[model samples]
Target: MNCEATKCQCGCDQETDQQKYEKIAEIIAKYKNQAGSLIQVLHAAQNIYGYLPLELQRFIAAGMDKPLAEVSGVITFYSFFSTQPKGKHTIRVCMGTACYVRGGKKLVDRLEDILKVQVGETTEDRKYTLDIARCIGACGLAPAMMIDDVVYKQVNPDKLETILAKY
Candidate 1:
């Protein structure tokens, strides 16, 4: 299957999402003769598209009269930027010193078992992606994990079964 198709198997049109590319094009046209439009266009494009694909970057580069290499360089340099699509649900485990000492590793293990996927991998259904971060500035809530933007604090191995059951 071409998962990259602009339309899904159920005939759900994703052109609404692709329309974001056209919106970017409009923004580019508006700023076609302006200076420093590269960064501005990149921001608008990323905002609309979620992530900047190579083709979008090329379009922006051409619109701004900039080289693809320069646009590519800027995209690569920013940690906030991404080339890949993100999962619907983002699961982040905190491996900070406090969380780590408070059974964070065990929590991670349990999550892996429940999700049937290793860290940094998406579930087979593409609903969730497991990620590990060094810290989330939540030392007060040690042994923490986050699903989407909701935080699960003081997580324990035994709670894994019940926690996953809700999902």
Candidate 2:
């Protein structure tokens, strides 16, 4: 949740994010009028700001002398890059053939209903972010999902509330 007292509603302190963005801007400036630094700069920016919004993307584009279209294209091309804020806890649902066939989508639906947010979105309280992964590899244990680093194999959609409560 955002601290209403802080000027920046983001998780990080306002001054700290300013320092970080300034440093990142410096890095982007190094590649001014250069090419092929879009990916690297976006990666660094995401690392610092968690996600890239239009304002920040504009900042990066101007700093690196790259077109906003090019930067936005790269960001959209890669599913790994997120334009929206992620929650404190990330929940990934596997959608591989095995898992899909074994009720993975159902589990995702259950999670969405429980959290009241669609896939790739964070709950209003910023407690959890739901994501869909092509495969989390545990095919043998089909219908797998993970919260942060902990993997839950053979998840039961009916028990999501109990399972999530442990977190």
Candidate number achieving the greatest TM-score relative to the actual structure: 2
- Candidate 2 local accuracy as lDDT? 0.87
Residue 93 lDDT (model 1):
91
In order of listing, the candidates' clash counts read 0, 0
| lDDT (Cα, tens digit) per residue for candidate 1, span 1-167 | 33344544555544555566778889999988987667777888888886788888888889888989999999888866666555678788999999999988887888888889888677888777878878899999999988887888898779867876666
Compose the digit string of candidate 2's lDDT tens values, residues 1-167.
25343245576645455666787888787776566778888988898888999999999888877789988999999998999988889999999999999999999999989999999999998889999889988999889999999989888998789889997
Q: After superposition, how far is residue 86 of candidate 1 from its true place, in Å?
A: 0.5
| Position 119, candidate 2: lDDT | 96
Predicted structure 2: clash tally: 0
lDDT of all predictions: 0.80, 0.87
Error of 1 at 111 (Å): 4.3
Best candidate, lDDT-wise?
2
**Candidate 1, position 31, lDDT:** 86
lDDT of 1: 0.80
